[model samples]
Target: MDEHEQVFQMDTGDYLGDCDYIWAESERERLRRLWLHHAQQLSDFYIKNESYIAAIKVQEKVQELFADAEDNYFILMKLYELLNNSGCR
Candidate 1:
């Protein structure tokens, strides 16, 4: 299967089938923290490297923290789009 199909398939069992939701919130929080932490690390690295592209990418991910803070998926998607148009993807 293609990458998109593989990704969709990998997640299908979570919601499409009789799967457990015991760790869903915990997993999501874990991932959120991981992404935020890594974005900080990338910010530091980009500061040293002066990588404009990488900085923009890190900003895009940093914006995603608002998902947990305010559930602002629209803003997050906008940031993602901005980063994509910034040629950092």
Candidate 2:
């Protein structure tokens, strides 16, 4: 299994000794929310920077974060289109 799957399979006790289950659950949820928030923030940052070339590069990296799928290709294509529409390299 991948590192992420292995981490998910581990119990609270495996990572945090004597931590309350409720607290662990909250922490996990908070982490997920923060990750998503950060991702959006990063996208906005790129957009505001007006660095279309850099944004395209970042979009390529983001595509790699997902497994091979139609959605992944669509996202990449959309990013490319956005860059092209912006008339930036």
Candidate 3:
């Protein structure tokens, strides 16, 4: 092993994946995924009900929340078009 590797065993476990460190991060991840699922369901319901305008409005609200996320903006527009083309209505 290299000198640095021998000096410090990284797996000392003193601070590895501690509850305090992982709790908030994992919770955020879980909530983020749940939020996306509900948002998609809302859009799907709006499309199925033939309320395309309301679906777009929901997308707009999501866009506002993630205004700095260019990829999300693109996805929002794509979802809008995809929902519009869906034969659900």
Candidate 4:
């Protein structure tokens, strides 16, 4: 299996101790990844359509949802740049 599957399997294993907490954390991570993936896709579509403000709005929600994600900050900065500069290279 790939690394993520391996890690998930390991984390959920009974011998690891605190299975409930591990499972909850794993599930939260899974949902976070799903949310980030879809949010990025939607934002990309908005950007492609020249809707920078809309894209920024979507990413802002992502930022709030995943505050610890450093990439979210960079994404928002880039989006703001695009909005102000109108497509910076």
Candidate 5:
């Protein structure tokens, strides 16, 4: 028997598959948080400058990324309210 085999008896394929699954999940989560941060920063900057339309666009673009997901609904609604109250269409 090989020295490596003598020390470790678990199936390598299963170990690799588990590792890949974990890495993929963590990577997806990291990307989601990153996008959310970027969207928030851009929206806040546009709103602070009184660019309500641009702020709404930013939120809408993020909504597209998430695709009808509940997480973005609140921000989208807030942006719409801001635009409506500002008379910016």
Candidate 6:
């Protein structure tokens, strides 16, 4: 048997704590960069495997992830349009 009594933790953070949540510009940039990285990886894989259909789906999802960011709209729209216009749809 152990000498010290075991304890379990349930509360992670205080809901009424004196804390704040701020959405900073740098945080937005970081998230955009992360999503773009995943998009690039998926694009590369699809190109190498000729998985056009699957790639289109994944690309749309990536666009959705960045949908709230107006800056990303044009680029994502272009990609999807390319696939559709390329007779891959």
List pairs with backbone clashes in candidate 4.
Answer: none
Per-residue lDDT over 19-88 for candidate 1, one digit per residue giving the tens place of the 0 to 100 score: 4566576776576566556555555565456555655555554554343554334534554565577686
Arrange candidates, best TM-score first.
4, 5, 3, 6, 1, 2
Tens-place lDDT per residue, model 4, 22-41, is 55776666765765676787
* Tens-digit per-residue lDDT, 1-89, candidate 6: 01110111121223323445454556655655765676656655664576666556555655565567564455456656766777876
The residue pairs that clash in candidate 6, if any, are: none
- The residue-by-residue lDDT of candidate 5 on 1-89, one tens digit each, is 23322222231222243465765776666756665676667678777888878777667766766676785688778878887888977
Report the number of the highest-lDDT candidate: 4
Q: Show where candidate 2 strays beyond 4 Å.
A: 1-23, 56-76, 85-89
Candidate 1: residue 59 lDDT (0-100):
57
How many clashing pairs does model 4 include? 0
Error of 4 at 87 (Å): 11
3 against 4, candidate with superior lDDT: 4
- Check candidate 2 and list the clashing pairs: none
Which residue ranges in model 5 land beyond 4 Å of their true spot? Answer: 1-22, 67-71
Best by TM-score: 4
User: What is the TM-score (0 to 1) of candidate 2?
Assistant: 0.43
> Per-model C-alpha lDDT, please?
0.50, 0.53, 0.57, 0.68, 0.65, 0.53
> Which RMSD values do the candidates have, in order?
8.5, 9.9, 16.8, 10.1, 16.2, 12.8
Residue 79 in candidate 3, Cα distance off native in Å: 7.5
Relative to the unseen true structure, what is the C-alpha lDDT of residue 49 in candidate 2, on a scale of 0 to 100? 73
What TM-score against the true fold does each predicted structure earn?
Answer: 0.44, 0.43, 0.49, 0.64, 0.60, 0.45
Clash pairs detected, candidate 5: none
Clashes of each: 0, 0, 0, 0, 0, 0
Give lDDT tens digits, candidate 2, residues 28-56: 65665454344445555666776556545
> Candidate 4 has what TM-score?
0.64
